[model samples]
Target: MTTTRTNKAWASNALAFATAATVTAIVTFTLHARVAADETPNSRPPMPVAQTQYKLQLSFEREQRFLGLIQAASRSQIGFEVPGAISEILVREGQAVAAGSPLASLDTQALVARRAAAAFDVDRASAELELASARTQRRAPLVKSGAISAQLFDDTRLAEKAVTSAFAAATAQLRALDIDLEKSVLRAPYAARIGRQLLDRGAVTQPGSAVFTLTSIADREAHIGVAVEQAQFLEVGQIYPLQWRSQSVRATLLAVRADVNPISMTTVAIFSVPADVEAFDGEPVSVSLPRTEPETGGWLPLSALIEGERGIWTVLALRERDNATLAVREAVEVLHVSGDQAYVRGSINDGDLVIADGVHRIAPGTLVAPISSSSVTLAEH
Candidate 1:
């Protein structure tokens, strides 16, 4: 009977121990599940972020400027008016010369001889005219006194008239020779800068042969070739602002060619440069042409742009709640993009939040943590 009682006590003790073990297993699994549920959503580390508020102000659109070479106003190929052997070159290359200054001299020996011959001919003609007048006066009285025949008197009168006409012709020839002699000494036509001299002393040159190149820099004009598409918008007498070498100047549109160049398909627009700008006859310069007036638009950092199937896009952060930051993808119209910023127009307002940072990783409806002002880089376009 005692052995039977020990067996019952052992069985009861074994059952109680098994039940306690099962209870402990159930409690441990419940605690583990509760801990896992608490940690799963908030386990990830927070992302680094930068935030910026959009700015609205009267911002001038950055103008697009083009480069052009400076050029002189007028260029002329200076040469001798008449052909002769070159005797002396008065000016050297790269010399500044005044208007009408002697540039070169042709061989004046032959010209001088011709001039002297013409002068002698004029003197001889004058003497011959005096003699003929005297002869005519003396013969007139003889004819009236019947000492000479009427035919003889008429013949002598005709001879005197012929000699008078020949004298006049010889005098005119002398004047022409004198003018040619003066032209042998070449003189500059205008105040100009002289280029390379083609001939030295004793070199024979033909008429119209280039002796030197002369360029007038006074009242220089800037000639630029504008593309045909752009040239069509330009009008005569329009004033365009220009900047050259950090100097501000105004250029007046003088004229535009009606036809475009076949090779370049560009039309020529002539702009009269100010007298003080100091430009050379063919030196190029930078030109700033105003296409249209400035229009109001929203500007954003260039980093905010995201490229995808919608082409270039930007993420606009909408303030859903005071503490929660939500971003939405929006298509924006880019008007002018310049240096680290873009002038854009879109459905969003000027003061809207633009996602400049964290753009590559975030998508539409992304929850973002807003960074403080110290972390954001804000720059004006």
Candidate 2:
């Protein structure tokens, strides 16, 4: 048609001049990215954190532990102040005795035949007090030579004062058969070990029963019941370490029980042990104790706390200010954890810093960049 309508009006004026030079280079690149984002100056550059350096510590008091029991700070039982029949048991159940040793023997065969009938009534009362002092010294010169009558010299001076009161009742029955032959020999009062024997060899027993137990194992102890506020932090001579078997052993406290065991209502204490603690007489032993007050807390490290809520606890620390280093939070209370650390009480002080990574999301006034974990090396977690 007129040369194809002048080549379609020159391709619609070259497509409206390349759509107005692509809308004027997208409106001059969106106004030079809005004036370089308003002359850029939103500044940012802090946040590195990782910190750690609170130190000041000194709170101590939460120990507790438990397992305790081991006994034998004395243990007695050894009965036999007079019966009989166990004619010889000489110690065995764990033997090892010393102070007075002996241990058993009561077949005094009718007490050595009543001590040979009280030594034949003290040899017939020393032959009736030497025939009543030779007839009261030959009738005191025959009753002053009246020869013999004055009621026959007062009936031979009342038969020599009734033979000197039957020779003083036969020397008090030969001193009660020499104290029943020295209490039928039972012995062993201290330095001991034979913890049990009850009554072996012929048995019989009675006058107070219980034949052998003796224990003492060189003064051992370790009772532990606590809780009257842990027996008010046990005192009596204070020493305390305990553990036994797994070793440690230091003991000492020796007594706190002013009464209060009515079946573990708790409050016993008693320690002592340490004869190299081989621990026996009932055995168990663990004992820790401590806590009675004095614990304010602030150790930290359990990844620097967090758990909050009613049981409360938080941390983060770092503080500084205007020049930067923010992250402050803190709340804490924790009170004890140990192995990877954590005692906490916090409003956090003493060279503070903290933030040793409690999930480290970072925020509270952020700005961080702390770094000083003694110049860093950590890495174990």
Candidate 3:
């Protein structure tokens, strides 16, 4: 029993010594690793920051959009010139018609009867005119040769002249009737689309009354109202982009009216759209114009700016002072913002290194290693 107890004590002591040696070795390795890390180039380097260069600009172009309306180039109320009962309407509403296409016609039963009667009168007049001419020729010779008495010859000539006048009057009446008949039919004056049908068949219409509203399909125009100051920059015959029904279309500037709109307090600008574009009349559209603002500022990423006390803003810029690069806070006034970039003028100079992002985590005087972005990135919100 004594020998067994001694053996058990020896084994316990050996296990204890082995555990202590393992612990010591681990502690020594940790200390050596720490020392090696301290001897390296930078035990704790400055925080790396994304930066961008500031480019100073004398002015900036700001895009401004103006609303407008689309309209057909020509809209007209068309109707027949003669007063008559409507016999037929050839075209329906919204129908496309070519130039000279028949639109409607007036009832011609009475007109036809009158024209026939006038034709009979014209035929009778022609026969009478021929007989009168023969009689005048024959009577002239008779009076000269003294075969007939002077008084009788003169009476014959006078009767012939009266017949001639009567014949001319009858012929003119027939021609007038023919014109009235032709005027009873209405036709399209140009290539157009029927916008409205104002009258129906079997309705009697007077002269100059509207029968249809036709809108020209060949040409379309957009009439945009822009600010008076902005309109001055527009040039006639210049091409511009327009927004129509969520689509982009190009149009040519046609004219700028001299008068200003009283309600909108804007000037009117007219633009002509291409023929191939499918657009509706009286639709809404918009045009954008770039206007230069006279101000000196520099462009920077919006991420570089931070909000400060009441209407003030802050941006972190890298500066070298006391032989160390330090982050310097600048107070700036934002002149304009487009997409992800801002035009600002403040206590900053051209070519100043501005932190592009992550400004919240950094302090004003924190040492920073400015790693410039190779290229600036901009994205629409």
Candidate 4:
């Protein structure tokens, strides 16, 4: 009976130990699940990204500036009228010359000889005419007094008229020689800068051969070829703004060609540069012409433009209540592009949030978390 009682006691002890272990395990599991549930929020959403838009002015068409060449007002190739050996060269290249200044002289030996012969002829003719006049006067009185024959008087009168004609011819020859002598020396025709010398001392030059090139820069002008379509917008006397080397210059349209060039089909326009503006011949410059009235337009980052099969488009992000987001794709007409800013007209408003960076990665009606754009750091290439 004692053995049976010990067995019952052992069985009872084992049952209590098993029950205590099961209760401890249940309490530890429940506390761990509760702690995990409290640490994690089940319905948290991401933050939305912030975007920026810039206000811009819109116009019909932005003015375009074009490059052009600067040129002298006038240019001429100076030459001698007579052929002769060069005796002297007075002007040097790049020298400033005035009108009527002696530029050079040629050997005048032959011209001087011809002039002397002409003067001798004039003197001989004058002497003959004086003798004829005296004989005619003396013979007229003799004929009246019957001291000389009437035929002799007629001969004297004819001789006087013939001598008078010869004298006049000789005088004209002297004057012709004088002009030829003066032509042997070349003079500047106008104020200009001398270019390369074609003839040097002792060099023989032919008549009409270039002696030097002269260009006038006091009043400058530019000749430009304009297309037929653009020619219609240009008019004579219209003022246009020009910029060169960060300097502003005003140019006036002097004239426009009525006929178009057959080869290029372009009209030629001549513009006079302002006198005070500094420029050089054949140097290129930039011209800015205003085409439309000035007004404000919308400006957006160039990244916002999405070009696809349908053309360029932009995505505008809209925010709604309950932190919901929506995007709308709209067609945009780009007027002009300057640097990274694009002037466009579309459904976008001034304060509207347009997808700037990473525009091509997103689509319309996409849910986006608003995040600070400044927080994203771009790696430098």
**TM-score of each model, paired residue for residue:** 0.69, 0.39, 0.82, 0.67
lDDT of 2: 0.75
Candidate 4 error regions (>4 Å) = 1-59, 65-67, 138-151, 262-264, 291-335, 338-341, 345-381
The worst-scoring run of ten residues by lDDT in candidate 1 lies at 40-49
Stretches of candidate 2 exceeding 4 Å from the true structure = 1-71, 75-105, 108-116, 119-123, 130-134, 141-173, 176-178, 185-194, 202-211, 216-220, 223-298, 305-350, 356-359, 363-381
Rank order by lDDT, top first?
A: 3, 1, 4, 2
Residue 199 lDDT, candidate 3, scale 0-100: 93
The worst-scoring run of ten residues by lDDT in candidate 3 lies at: 372-381
Clashes of each: 15, 1, 0, 15
What is candidate 1's lDDT per residue for 1-381, written digit by digit as tens?
Answer: 999999999999999999999999999999999899877735534444576666655544465565555566768897888889988888888888898899998887887788788888888888988888888899999999999999998988888888889888888988887788788889988888997787788888888898998887575777677777677877789888766777777889888888888997777787788878866555657676545436666667778877667576655665665555677777777777777877776667777777777588876766666677456666644
Error of 4 at 85 (Å): 0.7
Model 2, 66-150: lDDT tens digits are 7768888787787778877877777688977888878887888787787787788778867877886787778778778887767
lDDT, candidate 2, at 105: 77
Candidate number with greatest TM-score: 3
Residue 187 CA displacement from its true place in model 4, Å: 1.2
Name the lDDT value of residue 131 in candidate 3.
87
Candidate 4 lDDT, tens digit per residue, 163-277? 9999999999999988878988899887778988987899998888999988875777877776666778887898877776688777888987889989988776778888777
TM-score, cand. 4: 0.67
